[model samples]
Target: MAAHTAIARPPLVPEIPLHLATEITPIWQATEAWLGEQGIEPPFWAFAWPGSQALARWVLDEPGLVAGKRVLDFAAGGGLAAIAAARAGAAMAEAAEIDPLAHAATRLNARLNGVTVVEAPGDVVGSPCRWDTILAGDVCYEAPMTNHILPWLRRLAAEGAAVILADPGRAYLPGAGLREVARYAVPVTRELEDREERVVTLFRVLP
Candidate 1:
């Protein structure tokens, strides 16, 4: 078995405009069979989820809202939301993922979109630095993860930061206090899971 190494946080990169190629780009992610083919790894963050792609497409449908805001894309697999926020004119865009491979993928996707994305991880949570806006997608499918992240999000929102989540009615999404901002019917492939279709809804955390 390959031993895991200590997690090292990477530096933040600059911001850039949205790319035209994102629309045509095929979002290929690892499925259960695919992971088995490649020899499944312990860390789950190496692969991007279908819900994340759904959130990304939903973000693309909106413009002008994120301009000039400090944005944090939490659990940013493939940095889809980070790239979208940057394209939408976020002043500083950071992609936070705990997995090293996902961090690398975030950087690669940032470059592919001609954007500079900062890579941060879960360890950065509760740090002195605060973002004007925080975005999370497909993060609440698991009860433990949702329980862990919900308090952090609430704390951030309580501190007056704008927090948003794009979820496909995942089992763990809190039933209260999220205002619907937008919705999208995302075309999903079976590359990530059994679900071939999903309706993603964006919500704004109210103060």
Candidate 2:
């Protein structure tokens, strides 16, 4: 068996409560704990994706929105959004990520949150399973990935799934019919940095 070593971490700071409370924390202490336990470094998006925490925080604060809904958290990294959705009374919650490493981290975080997350990436095209709502956080920063995801999201909407996105005014978030439901001024740091770092808006994909 491989030897395990405890990783020391700085004490976590208090996170401010956003609109959605029971659903998520602005700073995901559970994800932090899970990452420490696994001793795995995070992927680029986890660090680079702007407005991720803000989105998760907002989702956590709004349980009524997700209540009784079947939710799919696409490209979930630390499973923050999925966890929040589950706590918000979503009938079903699942997470999907392209990277196997992210899937592992998502599962670890999910377990930390006392929830279950399906750890696999499925076809963006013609999904066999149906979901009432699809949650996407910080997925519109990259041009290529945005190009790939937007069409599929449109298709999902056409198929009767509601798509919600959390974006920090990224270049790609515009041109989509995403109406801003909530907004927050999230504190950012250069320590764990992002390209266009700052506060962001959480928007719901309108039909």
Candidate 3:
């Protein structure tokens, strides 16, 4: 894990550094092997996804969006967005993930950046949200996952929580009820995406 930590830097948000994989394949091989030994899936938390990068960027540039708000980073791999929110002066910032290993990484990454982010445990989607702002990055990459999670996000938005998502042209993102507030050309490895770079759109989920 130390070797993994050695390779990562906040390539997108350099000011707020994070432990991220330098490359896609090699890190996944090593991390997945480690996970296999532990009987779990490969930890995607080890890498900085383009969507998360875009979300973090927007938060830093427009801190007023999160300032004084309670924030929740859904599926907060590596907790980059959550850290950004905390740094942007959100009243509270918290992260939630399904994988225990990912949660461990989130805590470590939070510490690395000198931020206090509470770990929101249990089924994040099933619970009532108390946050004023909720951020989700790169979660629309899969169909089943998108189908299952979007409704919960919509519900949160309807309940007056400010739910937003950053996505890089994924197959499953819905066509309606998303207001694009920002667009970014995010750098990514070819192994993880078809393009070496992607244009990520930061969308505000609306009623």
Candidate 4:
């Protein structure tokens, strides 16, 4: 995993260092070839996506939101937000990922940032909420994924967990029940997002 990525800080959240791919194509091809599979999902864990970058920035700047709370970074790619929560003095910071590679990357990145992020292995979609705050970044990109996770997230919110979602205008984001909390203009590469920047909106998920 370390062989293909370089240690670098994301553009928006420079305080945290992540193992990121310099280019998308090479990492994508390498992962596919290494797995010996076709039609595999792109390595989302190798890049700090706009949503997670925004979430990390918010948590770092406003530490009280997560300080002394049990925080969960849902669908944590590279564990940017989780690491930030830990740095900001959260009592417990946990990262949940279904992908083993992503879990490994999160552990590696957490260690690099001098933090500890508990790993929530496998699918956690239907699990009962065990966190005080939940940070879900860039999770609504695909329709099927959005459909699969939104209900559980909404349930968590309804159950008194603060479910926060950061979205960079992904197509599958729900049209209602989101109360905007913050917004950020996150810089990105055209090769990945087809744009130089993305305006990421952070919202508190309402049930």
lDDT of 3 by residue, 121-159 (tens): 766886787999999998887898998898899999999
Taking the candidates one at a time, how many backbone clashes does each contain? 1, 6, 1, 0
TM-score of 3: 0.92
Candidate 2 C-alpha error for residue 183, in Å = 0.8
Report every candidate's CA lDDT.
0.65, 0.61, 0.85, 0.95
lDDT of 2 at 12: 16
Which residue runs of candidate 2 sit more than 4 Å off their true CA positions? 1-50, 122-129, 192-197
Model 2 TM-score? Answer: 0.72
Native-to-model Cα distance after best TM-score fit, residue 122 in candidate 4, in Å:
0.9
Using TM-score, rank the candidates from best to worst: 4, 3, 1, 2
Pick by lDDT: which candidate is best?
Answer: 4
Clashing pairs in 3: 8-20
Q: Which of 1 and 3 is ahead in lDDT?
A: 3
Instruction: Put down candidate 1 lDDT per residue, 60-116, tens digits, no spaces.
Output: 556466778888888886687788778777888898877666676677667767887
Report the lDDT tens digits of candidate 2 across residue range 1-207. 001111111111123111211212222344456456543434432332445566566656777777898988887765667767876778988888765656655665556567766655754444654888888877887798788887777777777887888786677775857777877766555555343246677777765
Model 1, which residues run further than 4 Å from truth? 1-50
**Residue 13: error of model 3 in Å?**
1.2
State how far residue 116 of model 4 sits from its true place (Å): 0.2
Deviation of model 1 at 105, angstroms: 0.6
Q: What TM-score do all the candidates reach, one by one?
A: 0.74, 0.72, 0.92, 0.98
